[model samples]
Each structure stands twice: as C-alpha cells, then as structure tokens.
Target: MGPITSDQNAYAYSIYHLILYQKMLNNQFDTLGKLLTVTEKQVTGPIYHGLFSTAILTAHNFLTEFDKYFKADSGAAKEKIVLVKQALKPVIKEIKKWKDLENFRDHVLAHNFRNKHTGYTSVFSDSTFLRYDIPQTVSDLAILIQCIDFIGRAIQRYFQAEYDSVHTLIVQQRSGQSKKSMTVEELEQYLNQLNQEVRPAIQELDNKYGIEVKGGAGETLDHDRR
Candidate 1:
C-alpha cells in the first residue's frame, strides 16, 4: 500500500537470496543424485568433483545469508528470529558443527592461499589436504535443505503481509505482470501443494540413492589423514 522502506527492502532481498541459494543447493544435490543413480557407481573424478564443489559453495552461501537474517544480533525482529530459531534449532546446530565444511569452502574453494609448510598451493598438501566424505556431505546438505524449507514456510506464515507485498512487487517488476498477492489461505494451500510435490520426489531420490540423514559421528572432511 505504501513505498517499501529501506529496511523492508533489505530484509526482502535477504529472503530472496536465501531462497535463491537454497534452490541452487537443492538443484545441485538433485543432479548429483540422478547422476549417481544412472551410473550406479561411487563418486569420483571431474563430474562428481564439479557438482560437489558447486553444492558446497551454494551451501556456504545459504548458511552465511541465513545467519545474517536470523542470528541473535541480526536486525530481524526478535519474535521472527525466535520463531525461526525455535523451528530450526536442530538443523542450525548441525550446520554450526560443520566446521570442516566451512574450512574447506574458505581455504580450498573460495580462496587461494599457500600451505605454510610446503609453500605451495593449499589444494593438495599432506598437512592441509582435505578429503570430503560425500555421503556425509549429502546428509548434511539434506538437513540444510530442511532448514531452508522451514524458514521459508515460517516467513510466509508469520510475516504474511510483508512477504506477500514484497513478492507481488518482485513479480511485477520481473515479469511486468499485474499479479496480485495471494491471500493467506491461498498461500497456505500453495505451500502445501509444493510440499506434496517436492517431498515425494526427494524421498524417491533418497530411496534410490540410499541418501539418508545419518546423524552419526563423522567428520564432513578428513583433515587429519595425509
């Protein structure tokens, strides 16, 4: 009804970016799942490496963006933060425990630095070499996807007015469509419909690829082995 304030604009942009990265992460994993199924072989070499690299980078982007909006010091409303944290406590905790993933992303994927001992690129050193656990990473990414889905649903449900207004404006600007925002009931129905469509597909992939979220003790990457 009125011009969107800067804070609202920033908040909306953060949500948009989170959704974008989340989808990218999901797409990467989905492709990986299908490739594994078709090949029926253990992950190896360039194709798997390429997909895994993109997945981890997208995951890092999602987690950092999520922190900016939902962390304690974030400018997000206290109630909204509380709601998100309460809903996603387990997922957030698991994500925080993934220091190895963060380290790999920072040192290997996102930056270029030399090993202190070898004075060579840090990509493959006896001390700095990090071997990813593909199964574990897949499980962790699944949990991250759950977090993203829950946060998206919570924002839509709790901040219906702002979400609707922002979404409507975004659609209009992007497509030049005069589409009106959905009513609360419509939003709820749409979310339910989306869940119905997405859940089975994910489950099928999981069943086909044996990708279960094993909450067992295992490092995401082996940083100790030479």
Candidate 2:
C-alpha cells in the first residue's frame, strides 16, 4: 500500500476533526439548551455563564475551522467542499431567514464591540444597542444545531467513502482479515462518550421543564445512555 499522500492525509485530518467537532458542537448546543432551565438550580453564576459562553464560542469556532479544509488548494478538497456546499444549500437557506441571530453573531457572539463603549460616554445610546429576545435566541440555537447536524452527516458520508477506500488497501496488505484503524475506533468511542453525556441531561430537561428534544442528534439521544 502506498503511504497516505498529502491529499489523503488532508482528507483524513479533515474527516477526523469534522467528526469530533460536530459531536462536540452538538453536545454543547444541547447543554446550553438544558442550561436554560438548570441555571436556576446552580449555586454559582459562573457555572451558568461559563457553559453558555463556551458553547457560543465553540459553535462559531467549529464552523470557522470546518470551512478551512475546503479552502485548501487540493482538487479533492475542492470537490468535497463543493459537494458539501451543495448538500448544505437548503440548511443555509433556512439559516439565512434568522436575521436577528446573524446580527447577534456579528455584533456580539463573534466579537466584542468595545470601541463604541470606551469610558461609558458612548456616542451611541440604548436605542442603537443590539438586543436579543429569548424566543429568538432559542430559535437561533435550534437552527444552528440543525445546520451543524446536516453538515456533519454530509461530511461523514464523504469521510466514510475515504475510510472504505483506505480500509480496502489496509485489508489487501493484511490478507483476508479486515481490521479497522485504532484511531478511527477511538474517535467513534469519543463520539459515543459525548452522546452519553448529553442523553440523560436532555431527558432530565424534558422531564423537568417540558422542553422537547426536537430533532438533530437529540432524535437518538435516548438510544445509548451507557
């Protein structure tokens, strides 16, 4: 078997991280949604604030990083990204409908507009200040989670193709027996762990606050708790 080339290596790197990030991003989004109800029970304000802030930052960071693999000059990278963008076109359309969320991401989530508030004698007053409504926030998170799930699955399909190709080569060298890569299995285990963490929390939230699980990974949130 020829050693993995630069393009193959890049694809593997992208696939591994894509799986890891999507799972984490899903878990964080679920945690934040549950935090909506749990904040009242927490003893310290930091627990609530920290998780919320981390999830927000992480969602932005993962999407930003996921886009970088597509920016590569490799042909495979270009083709894969094109297909991904096509697959995501519908989700993208739905996301665009939420202008308030976009505004929040632009004005607050992605960056801090400290320049406008220097020394408290701000030129712009409350009228110009950006505000987020609760319903909008919840809706934004829901849309964001769905987008992540859609993109993640599309990438997973691409990655699975790559894995199968490589596994074929590995099996060829190893004779009739087929063995999966340890790294791939480890990543899957990590994903399973993340899923486990979120399952009970989501069920608790549903039981306590009556917040429905909705769609996305939450659909299978009940399947594996161990």
Candidate 3:
C-alpha cells in the first residue's frame, strides 16, 4: 500500500461522512414516505423537518471539508474558505431552493432561538416562541435531494481527476515487485481479518442498540420493537 498524506486522509474522511449521511437521509425518506401513507402530517412532518435540516447541514459540512482540504492551494492551504464561493457559483439555483430551509435551520432547528425575523413576538414579551412552519412536501424533499446529489456529483468530479492522476502513478509503479495483486491465500487472510474485526462490532451494535446487519436484501424486524 502507498503512504496516505494528510490531504488524502481528509478527502477520504469527507467522502465517508458524505456517503454515510446520504444513506441515513435515504433511510429517513423511506420511513417518512411509508408514514405518510398512513398519517401524513401527524407522523411525517416533524421527522421530515428534522432529517431535512440534518441532510442540509451534512451536505454543507461535506462541501466545507472538500474546499478546505481538497481544493486548497497546496502552497497556501492555511487560507480559510478558499475557492468555496467560486466553486458554488454553478449551483446557485439549488442553493436558492434551500433559503427557507436554511431559515428553519438557523431559527428553529440549529439555534432554537431568534434570527432576524423569527423566534420572537417582542424581545421583552413572554410569548417569544415561534412555530416551525416550513412547508416540506414530498416535492420539496425531492428538490433538496437533487441539490445534495448535485453536490455529490461535483465532489465526485473533483475527486475523479485526482484519482486519474493517482491511477497513472500506480500503473507506473505496477512493474515493481511490491505492487502486485494479493494471492488467494493473502486474500483469504484479509477476509478473515476483516470478519474478525467486523463481526464483533456488528454484535456490539446489536447488543447495545437493537440494530442488525442482516446479510441479504430482505429487511428483518426485531420482534421486541414491534
């Protein structure tokens, strides 16, 4: 294996979090869609709002990390927020769709207090709480998903270029004795190592959180939860 630099580590970390959050957001969407079939607003509304805010914040964090570590000037990476606004210029429409959601994030979800025009009737009054009334329909969620997907694609494009360069370097290195594919025995040993590492972690999750990793396409439920 090649030595990983700080920049590569940062990029890997950002990609991991981005994919994990996207999976979580997808699962949330599945649950919300099912719940909406039975009871739309009463069950799905709060969940949608919460997960929507989380998804947006997750995407923002991904972009922040991407710009900070991946797109930074190699000589002057200490520069903060470098090239981020310029990078985002192509996605302005998607960003505009998030304006009200951003407001909800700032006022109700993230801060839980007043923004410029929210969370207060009067500063001195006892009635200072405001309702979370952002209208998040399925269509709205679809738009949000589109924006997140766009960001993911953009990040992928940036990484693909880097990957191509790395691939060329690896190809050049392949003639060396140290850079060959693993033997069958080596692959088996690797699988055994992975199984040893992961099985315990999966069991721990099952024990502590009632979660499971069923090794197939079908979903299984814990009878206790039902």
Candidate 4:
C-alpha cells in the first residue's frame, strides 16, 4: 500500500481473504499506533470507558456506513454482534464460557447491567457511555488497557473473518474452485447447521434473561444500537 488508508483497506480486505490478503498482513499492525493517540486524548479514569465505547462505536459506525459493502443492511448493527459471535465461537467453546459473551452482548444491547468489572454496574444504557472504576495505579490502568486492546482486536478479527468469508467465496467462484473449496453458501449453511446443532445454548439465550445481543453505530440510521 502506498498510504495509510490503502494499507488499512488492504489489511482489512486481505484479512477477509478478499483478493489481497497477504498484502495487508505484510504491513503489520499500524492502526494500534493511531489508537494510542486516540486513547491519550480520551478522558482518563472511570469515564475512560468512553474511549473504549468510542472505539467500539467507531467500528459499529464503520460497519453501518459501509453497509453496502457488507452485503447486509447499511445499518445492520446486529452484524457486529454476529461477527463477534463468529470470532469468539471457538474460544468460548474452549473455555467453556460461551454464555458470557452472548450475555455481555445482550446486556450491552439493552439497558441491562451485569458487566463483571469491579465497578461496572451500569451496562450500555445506550451505546453513548459506560460505567467503570478509575484505575489507581499503572497496573490498574494497564488491566483496563488490556481489555480495551482485546476489544479492539476482536473488532478487527471479526471484520477479518466476515470479509474473508465473503472474499474467498468470490475467489472460489471465479476459479471454479467453489465446487471444491468451501463456498460462502456452504460455509453459511455449515454455520447455520452448527447453530441448529447447538441444542441448549442459543435457545436458552431467549429463555434466559440475557439472550439477544447487538452493537454498532448506525450512522445513516440510529448510530447508537451497535
């Protein structure tokens, strides 16, 4: 890529397996450098959650604004949740903590308040702000920073997985490898089967208190939901 924008686009698209996957990975992670300045400018202390919220909101908004490119509604904020689900599906199963994320997403979507943070009593009443405790020391702030980092990382990986899924399908189709390589139709069908295979959890999502989840900044729309 010749410039920052080109590099990121290449990276995002690449991660998605969309034509130039290696090109972007070849550039390494530069966006994190940018986030440093952003987080620095962000309000410090308990309100610092605003920084994370802003980051998440920015991603949500990006998805909404670029909906046409997403192959879904321009403001399909729920896609964020879906992407997160796609990315976390593996780890959740490994840790045997599947419900945690689904519940967290649901909590944030509505105005529920069950975040596990020490003082995170208030949940996403609206994607506008969140509640948290001000870290007392470097280590304290570091912990929050780590969590924020993970959140940011997740957004990217989720986007990468979805983008790759779509891009690869197209590649397969063009190459006539779709019949052999996994097609998007097949992948989705498999994912759907996986969902259907889940005998207890997804259904329990509705039966339990926290089931449905959502996130994203719906610019041309609500810009708040996701």
Candidate 5:
C-alpha cells in the first residue's frame, strides 16, 4: 500500500509503515464514497498516524480561518471542522488502542499463508475468516463514517455562511418582498453561471467523467431561513 508493494516487505520498509496504512485507508474511504450516498462523510487523504496528529490538523484549520468566519461572535460559525474535531476526538482516542491490531491480524494471516498446505474448505477456515475480516471491515467503516461526519459538518458550515452572505445581499437590495427567501432570480443566476461558464470548461468531468458538481444543492438552498 505504501511505496513498498506488499506486506512481506512492510517490516523491511518499516519507516513507511504509516504511509502504507494511510494508503490502504484512503482506498477504503474511496470505496465508501462509491457505496454510500450519505453526505456526512470523512474522506481525508489517508490514514492518520494517530489521533493527536488529527487533532492538531483540525485545530490548525480552525485557527487559520478563525476571524473570517467566527469574527469573535457566538452566532457566527467558525467552521464545521470545529464541531467535527470535537466529535472525533473521543473516537480517535479509542482507535489508538486498536492501532496494532491490524498488524497483528496481518501477521496471523501471513503466518497462515506461509504454512498453507493447499486451499481447502472447512468450517474452521470459514470461522477464522470471520474473526479478522469482521473487525477490519468495522474499522474501515468507522473511519469512513467519521469522514462523513467531517464532510457533512463542513458542508453545513458552508451552507450557513453562504446563506448569510446571500441574505446580506438581499437585505442590501431592500426589495419590497413579502418573503425573506432566495429569489428565483438568484437560482437562475447561480444555475446559469454553473451551467454555462463553469460547465463548458469542466464538461469532461461534469458531463462525461461522471463528476457531480452540484454539491448537494438540496432544497434548503431554496428557502431563506432568516
């Protein structure tokens, strides 16, 4: 999974062990995006070395953009990463306990591979597969679910800020309107920009390569919640 090719060489390239694990982790999350339709997903670039590192990165992102979003106000949002890091801190602490479990399981499987007389069917073999397979899959899913949380929270934050900006624009217009919601003009204007200016250049990804640029612009974008 790392620069090294296989588990057989993992110990030999122990320096890159973390890199290898992260590579495998990224693959697992990529699979999650393909399998699930959920918006709240955690898809970081790779497996992290530990929870401490992750917490640090979260803090970094939060502090870097503090004033722009939070602006020293409680009502304003800093970012959803602020919330998600809080959600993840406890879970990541627990995962640290299981850090070596993956390697231990891999060692067991490698041992089995080395001693393999031949491939055969048996209840014992089937049961052993359940043992490691279940836990490995669970870890992968847990991580992916966390990724979902991270992404979903960030999107919510974006929605809030974007909403605030648009609402401010509407107020500045001071149009005599009964409702305080997005005008159809807003939707048409936004969509026209997306469909024409952006689409033409990104058509390969937008039209052919199967990239969805819509970013879950769901019904909430329609109503002005102010």
Candidate 6:
C-alpha cells in the first residue's frame, strides 16, 4: 500500500464511526433486553435507565453518521444511494414518526438544559418535558436494530476494497514485506473468492444467531430475529 489519499481517509473515517456507533447501540439494546427479561427491577431500575439513555444517544449518533453517507453529495454513486434508501425506507419512516423520542433525547439526554418557562429538564419536569415512554422507546429501538444491521452490511459490501487494502497493508507491515496495493480486478476477484469461502461460515453463524438470509447475492441480507 502507498500513502493514503484524502478520499480514502475520509471514507475510512466515516465507516469507522458508523461501525463504532452501531456496535454501541446494539450492545446497549442487547443488555437492556436481558435486563427487562429478568424479574429484578428493584435492583436493575437505575441500571435500566442508564442503559436506555445510552441506547437512545447511540441510536442518534448512528443515524447521524448514516445520513452523512446517504446524502446526495456524499461521494457514493447515485444508484447505490438509491438502493440504500429503498432498503431503509421503513426505518426512515419510523424515524420521522419519533418526534417525542427525538425531543426526549435532545432535552433530557443530550442537553439536559431546562427551558425556564416550560420547565423541561429532568423526568420530573412539567408538561413541556417529554417524559420517556419505555415501551414505545423499546419498540422504536427494536426497529432501529434493523437499520443498524442493514447499514452495517451495506458498509461492508460497499467498502470491501478499502477494508481489504488496509488489512493487506497491515499484514505486509507485520511480516516485514513490501506493501502492495491491489488493482481493481484483483480486488474484485479477491472479494468474490472470499465470499465463496465465507458463505458457509456466515450461514452457520446466522443459524446460531437465528438470522435468516432472505435475499440473493449482492442484495440486502435480511434477518429474522428470534
């Protein structure tokens, strides 16, 4: 590999943050789900609140990062952007419907600043404060998990070449060999071969996790969460 260009750096940065936020959101939700199932709310009340708040913030961060990539001038091909948008159409609609959740996130979790006249700060704040609805919020987060999964797979597919180049350069450096960049055709062949090799493993793991791959190759990988 050679010196990284500005475009590569920018692409790497966006993908890195998107994955980071996605993982955080998933972890928070997973933990919250387990906590909810246990019959120990007395002990887990504070823990649940904290985890839920973090999950909300993480979801916001994930969506914001996703929008950057989904935008018209984000350097992604127009057709790719259209496909991503179509895949995420339901998630986008739900996000638009989450006005109260957004307000709660903005006032209580993100800012924590009171509107003096309306007294909108803490959970105890007056009518203006958007009180948290645990059930509704949980349902929303569950839907957003689909968004997270789709975006994660999209990023992996869209930027496979960049990821492979970085991984190869790291491997070369570790082995004290000269770094070499792959040509476009080489990258495509590598990805095709890699997918063939990983398909069985992917299916096995999907079975373990109760994920169902419903679409053809190069299409959105859908999951039937257990």
Best by TM-score: 1
Off by over 4 Å in 5: 1-20, 36-92, 97-107, 112-124, 132-226
For model 6, how does the per-residue alpha-carbon lDDT over 165-212 read when each residue is reduced to its tens digit?
665656667898567689999998997787778777776776676665
Model 3 agreement with the true structure over 1-226: per-residue lDDT tens digits? 2544666555444544454455555656665566456544464456655655666665555445554644433543224224434565566456454445445555544554334464343412443222433335655555565555665555545454444445555567776757678999999899777776666655666667755445521123322332
TM-scores for candidates 1 onward, in order: 0.56, 0.47, 0.44, 0.23, 0.24, 0.54
Of 1 and 5, the candidate ranking higher by lDDT: 1
In order, the Cα lDDT scores of the candidates are 0.59, 0.56, 0.52, 0.40, 0.39, 0.59
Query: Cα deviation of 212 in candidate 5 (Å)?
Result: 40
Off by over 4 Å in 4: 1-25, 40-180, 214-226
Residues 1-226 of candidate 1 have per-residue lDDT tens digits of 3556765766665666666666566565566556545433465456665766666677677778777763333555555757765876776676666566666776566654344334456654463534543224444445655565565565556656665667677777878756778999999899777766666666666567665544312212222322
Model 3 lDDT on a 0 to 1 scale: 0.52
Q: Write the per-residue lDDT of candidate 4 for residues 1-226, one digit (tens) a residue.
A: 1222432443344334322322232222243334345545454444444333333333333323333332333234346645754764553233222123233343452333444442455544433222322232333333333443444456555565545555655666789743456789989898767655664554455446543334311111212332
The alpha-carbon lDDT assigned to residue 63 of candidate 4 equals: 29
Q: Give candidate 1's error at residue 29 in angstroms.
A: 3.2
List clashing residue pairs in candidate 5.
22-47, 40-148, 41-147, 41-148, 42-147, 42-148
Candidate 4 Cα lDDT to native: 0.40
The window of 10 residues in a row where model 6 has the poorest summed lDDT is 217-226
User: Between prediction 1 and prediction 4, which has the larger TM-score?
Assistant: 1
Give model 3 RMSD, 1 decimal.
11.6
lDDT of 6: 0.59
lDDT of 6 at 124: 44
Off by over 4 Å in 3: 7-12, 35-46, 66-70, 74-92, 100-103, 111-135, 153-226
The digit string of per-residue lDDT tens for model 5 on 1-226 reads: 1232233232222212222233334444555554344443343323422322233233223322321332212322333435644655654454444343334333433353221322533324445433432223334555534543453344344444343444454566687676776699998888876665654455454445454434422222333422
Rank order (by TM-score, best first): 1, 6, 2, 3, 5, 4
